[model samples]
Target: MPRRVAIIATGQTKHTARRLDVNIRELITEAVTRALQDADLTMRDIDAVLLGNMEPFEGFLFPELWAVEGWGGYMKPSVKFNTGGTVGTTTAIAAYYYVASGIYDVVMAVGFEKQSEGHTQTAITTVGDPIWERSVMAGAIGNFAVMATTYMHESGVTEEQAAKAAVKARRNACLNEYAHLQMPDITVEDVLRSEVLAYPVKRLDMCPQSDGAVAVIFAEESKAQRLAPRPAWIRAVATAHEQQYMGDSPKRLAEMRSLIAASRRAYQAAGITNPRKELDVAEIYEVASFAELAMYENLGFCDRGEGGKLIDMGVTELTGELPVNPSGGVMSTNPIGATALIRVAEAALQIMGKAGRRQVEGARMALATGYGGNAWTDVMILSQEKP
Candidate 1:
């Protein structure tokens, strides 16, 4: 059997619209530096370095060659993953498996994106189904718009409910210093009134493209305590994917098959029969407001079609029964490449008691997820207790 592993430290650069001051390498270095300091380690202490990002988004090919010295991968085995938006979760899982398998004692995983420097929508456009690429979708906005509208029809969720979710995310982001967008006084009405980007998805409902990076140190079980006083144990991880075509499922948004599969298996592995009561906090990937609501139903936080009700009841509020996306979430800050890793980093920070004003008090268990526009999902469970 493989040895246990845990996240000893995590760090992230403040996310924002543009960072013309620093190059991509420097941006990655910023996050890596903070992670190293948090772990109290130097390059000599790291066994291997793993990195990931959507190269198309930044128009870079073979990124490890470009940012070798940036993430301290000098003379170290460097592996890069280009799994689109799920890159972060896939990279972190690789690090965990390496440590758990005894191939490495300590590993660093970095996820970064400089979205301002590229045309993400255009890049995303090139990766869609060739059959319906031109006629059906214009990129993520058009695809998600269809999903959101269909979900509304089948689940009885309203634009008002999605607007509430948007309000919750941005308002919660006000406490996170690294969040890209902070709308402290944003209200549901403001979301409803904002200019619609594509149907129900308003400017306020969608995530902003940002330039940011996030890094975390994963260690073998024995080295975990030495690395940090409190480590976030990797309790369980699960992933699921759907067909490549976006039109594979008509009710894709209303009933996310990949998310449902991933969350169920991950929860089972973590021995969580009641997620809402068992997990303390959740940092899910919601590119838009409606996605979160859809996730609420698929993740078993509530019954099907009750996502709207869940938001209206404030169940996922900052101080509510179970807080979701206390780090502002993708709805407020989405650096596609790093967004998934940001979710994991925030969850680990909560477990380590290192989260600043946005920390969930006495948080012992947390859940994080990664969503890919390519029809895939990754779910990871972290806890204060050893698995």
Candidate 2:
């Protein structure tokens, strides 16, 4: 049998459009130090390290070669990963496998991004097909705009409802100290009034290009129990990928076949029949406001085309039955490489009662998702009780 794995501690730096005070190395070190302090462990206790970053975004090559010292991987096995925005969660899941395989008892997973150092749009444009989509690509905004338009046409979801998601995320961010966009007084009207970067996708509706880092410590069952009073057990993890071509899945965002498939397998592995009620909270990779509403349906939080209704009924608010994105979600803060990992870390924190002001009251089970490249999806379930 595979060894049980759990997250004993998690840490994050304050997210912002720019972190001029620290370079990439110092930024990563800051998160690592905080994670170690949270777990009451030193570098001596870590058996290995996994780092995630969108190297192209920073024009950096071989990041792990130089980031080793900052992550305390000087004499330990270490590796790096890059999968667009899913890099962070991919790294975390890899670390989980490392410990569960019994090759390492303890591991540190870190994800960081310094978007201010490079041209984010230029880096994102490279994600498209070189010959076909690259020449006409408008980066993430245009892609999401097209997806949002298709969703609106098919599901009857209106701009006002999408703006509600923006409002909820920013308001929720106000409670999270490490979150980037904390708009306590934001309203749907404000979102609609925000400048339109792309049709149907306004400024407030998109996640900010943030400079931040997050770190989480994982350990085997015995080590986990000794490391923390309440370790968030890793119940299940699943990942699904589709063809890279945008036209391959015309209704990609609206239907999100990858997310549906990943969530189905993950929920099954965790023995969850009814996600809306079985899961206490959710931390999703909602890159855009409309994407959140669309994910509500794709993740089986509600029936198809009922996502707007769910949001209208306050079903995803902080005090709702199954609160989603209580950490303000990607719509509030997105460090690209670290965005997905923050979802897992936030879920673990909720289970550990360490989410501070954004904690879901009495949360025992939670779901985290990582979405990237319009082609990949990762789903994970974490709980207070062992699975």
Candidate 3:
């Protein structure tokens, strides 16, 4: 069995539509510097560095080679991941293994994306099967629009319910200093009136392309205890992937097979028989408003098609039975590559009792998830107590 590993520190840059003030390298350095400071350690203390980003989105290949100095990986062992949106959490899991295997004492994982520097939609169009789905694909919005329509037809989920989710996410972003969209006064009415991007999906209902970076430090039990007053222990991790072709699963978004499988495995490994009751908070990757509701069911927070009811009952509010996306989630700040890692970082902050204004009172356990490429899911559980 792998040894215990804990998150010692986490840091993120202020997310925005465009970060013209700094280049990609500087953007990465900002997050890395803050993480090292938060851990009360220097570059010399990091045994290895792991980084990830959606290279196509940034029009760059082999980014780590030129950006190494910015993340302090000049002479340390380093690896990079480029898995579409799940790159962030994938990189974090890699760091966890590095420490858990007893090969490294301290590891830093970083994920970033400068979407403004490249053609995001054009890049995303290439994700589909080149010979089969590429020509007809209209990027993520078109794909999600179809999914949203299917969900509404089968589950009676109205556009208003999705609007409520959009309002909740942007409102929550008001309390987060680093969030890109801080709409404290946003309402369901405003979301309903927003320009329709794709049928059943409005402009406010989708996540924006953002520029940002996130860095996190993982350490073995002994070093973690010495570094952080309250370390977020990694209790369990699970990942699942399915056939890449969208046509392979016609009801893909509604079923979300990968998310269900990954969450089930993670819950079993964490000894969580009842996730809604056992997990204190969750920071799920909700790329679109409707996706959040779908996740509530797939993650076993509620029965299928009952996601809308959870939001209506305030069950997932900041002060409810389980708070979801208190950091505003991907809806408020989606840097694609860093978005998933941000979910993990936010969960760790809650477990460490370091989440400011948006903190969940006395949170002891938290769940985070990563979704990508229409069929991949990554689930991680963190807790204040050792597992």
Candidate that scores best on lDDT: 2
- The parts of candidate 3 lying over 4 Å away from their true place are none
* Tens digit of per-residue lDDT, candidate 2, span 1-387: 779999999989999999999999899999999999999999898899999999999997777887677767787898889988789889989998999999999999999999999988888888888888889875899987888899988899999999999999999999999999999999999999999998989999999999999999999999899989999999999999887778754488778988999999999999999999999999999999899999999999999999999999999999999899999999999999899999999999999999999999999999999999888998889999987
Better of 1 and 2 by lDDT: 2
Residue-level lDDT of model 1, residues 1-387, one tens digit each, is: 889999998879999999999999999999999999998999899999999899998888777889887888888977998887788998888888889888899999999999999999888887786676755676688778888888999999999999999999998899999999999999889999999899978888899999999999999988898878999999998889888765555478888888999999999999999999999999999889999999999999999999999999999998998999999999999888889999999999999999899999999999999988738999989999999
Cα RMSD for candidates in order: 1.0, 0.8, 0.8
Can you give the lDDT of residue 126 in candidate 1? 77
lDDT value for model 1: 0.91
Range of the 10 consecutive residues with the lowest summed lDDT in candidate 2: 244-253
Distance from true location, Cα of 139 in model 2, Å: 1.1
lDDT of 2 at 50: 94
In the predicted model 2, the residue pairs found to clash are: none
